[model samples]
Target: MYRWLLLSYPRDYRRKRGAEILETVRDTAVTHRGTRVAANLVRHGLRARLGRPASRTVVLWATVFTLACGLFTASFGTWLTWLGSRPLDHDELAVAVNQLYPDKPVSHIDRDDPPSVFIIYGSPLSWSSASDLLLGDGGEYSLAGLGASFEQLPADSRPRVLAELLQRLRASGWDDTEAVYSNAYDCVPDDPRCDPATIPSNITVYAQRGDDILEVSINDDSTTPKMSLALTRSTPWSAYPVGVVAFVLGALSGWCLFGWASRRLEVRGPLAQGSAKFLFGFAMVMWWAPILLSTSLMLSHHLSEPHPRWHPLWEWLGQPAMSLAFLCGCLALGVAALSHRLPADQTLAHP
Candidate 1:
């Protein structure tokens, strides 16, 4: 078991002190139970790793590598989270639209409709609310073909652009004006008489309030439901995979630094070695503390109402916390290596 634990130390450490460490472990084992022996072995390894000084070249390179990896991993993870949370595909689009117009009767329009007006709605609250409604809680709807609609728009003509947007909306199931109003009104319950479904299908209404613009469909059977906008322009969040890559690199650097430090510190001494071993034991606690805390926080959040203010910070801390834990483990190993390096004079006094 001691030999196996020694494997956790740097290669130079194992080569230099493996047999002596095992012999000491065996002697210690005779005084304690197997579990305690195992624990002590771990403690010793950590001390050796921490007391050693890292080479300048190794430290510099390791630090650079760690930073690069951490940033890349963090960025990539953030992007993945964003992408995973965003709406996608036809079904996703349908859901988004439905949240925006809950009472609106949505149906796919036949592809034969002529040119028509299109109105795009934009508002941070509206977008957030709709996204939450559609993608967050209600999983029944999705956005599918909007990508194709935007792609097919004419570069030179405003009407063509309008037509394409309208066509995309129609395809996503906004075919009736009354239905649109009814859905909108239903969703916006504060509006007393704004029953979107009750609005006449043939009404040529253009309602603009603040940043919102509502373009009503004129024909009852136009097959595309007209849209109302609270705002006009919107941009999707771009996905970045670099952050995750960075996080991984940071962890690797930490590990290497830990090993280098361990090799340098594991000398033969009594008081010095014992102190290093104790420090290594303490370091182990620090290494795992964040992981335990974060896991507990996550569990607590899942069990209760999510406190919005803390969520972002918690997520941001995740990568760093994990990297730090890994570094701590390495530090512990280094400390253990240091503890094993007892001087000949001190060894006799301590023994």
Candidate 2:
């Protein structure tokens, strides 16, 4: 076990002192001591990679990663804005009255603050004495393809409208819809969180027709029932901005650590800043490289042939490929750095 752990260090470090390290581990065979040694080994190994010369491939991939990340982040907001601005599929309300809405007049409200149900938009408390209000769950509409109708409707009326919608959806012709009940549809049937069994308060129905899918969830406890209509074609582009933000923050953190390691080496010893920085950056961002590279490859492969179902396989390989590339990169750079550095501070190199 310690032999494998020592292998985590740069090959040069191991070559010079592998036997001595092994002897130390044998002498101090305590489990906690072994864990501490493993941690130090990893730290020193990764740090050592930062003082080496990088190859052309390393520099090329690093530049690609940085530019691709920068471009994706820069354009992510625009993508989200475009997605938000997409024109909703507005069919004749007259035709949809029996299918989606009640036979009541839809109240006019602000475009940003639309109604939850087919009828009026008001708080349940505002008119609690009169009628049951239907409150629209603003986000559920985005998923169900309801566009944002429920936002303005009275909360008490929500259950009534939701139940009506569900009944109509179930009665509609579903032969064509069943053939295309895909994961792309709204309120995904396979979504574990949205499972009807989990939400004991809600009576749920999922019905698909043509490009439209309706998810009616009437919570027995809450006056408002969640109803959503979804378009299968409307992909989840809304998630782009969020993913871009997370990717940027993670990449930035890794880049900073790499820079710090390289800078420290430059100040303390004879380290090649140019190559070390190149390799370190490459290793740091290679986690996203598979995703970036595979997307194009998959697209091209799809266009050339017809691989609609191979996407999951490629996605599965992305993380593992990233980890392997990063590890190999670190080891390669570590070997190069140790060989190139002057012998003046060999002691410093050990740490």
In the range 295-331, model 2's lDDT, one tens digit per residue, is 7776676565322123322232242224355455557
C-alpha TM-scores of all predictions: 0.31, 0.29
Q: How accurate is candidate 1 locally (lDDT)?
A: 0.44
Local distance difference test, each candidate: 0.44, 0.44
**Model 2, 93: alpha-carbon shift in Å?**
6.1
- Cα lDDT tens digits for candidate 1, 1-351: 567787656666779988987888788788789898787676656445544444344344334434534543554565445344433234444444454445545443222221111111311223444443333332212112131111121223534434544555556444413222122223456688666656433323233222222343323222333332221111122333444454666565565565564454454457664676576556655544544666677778645532212232223334333544545555765556543433456444554
* Deviation (Å) of 274 in candidate 1: 27
Error of 1 at 308 (Å): 8.9
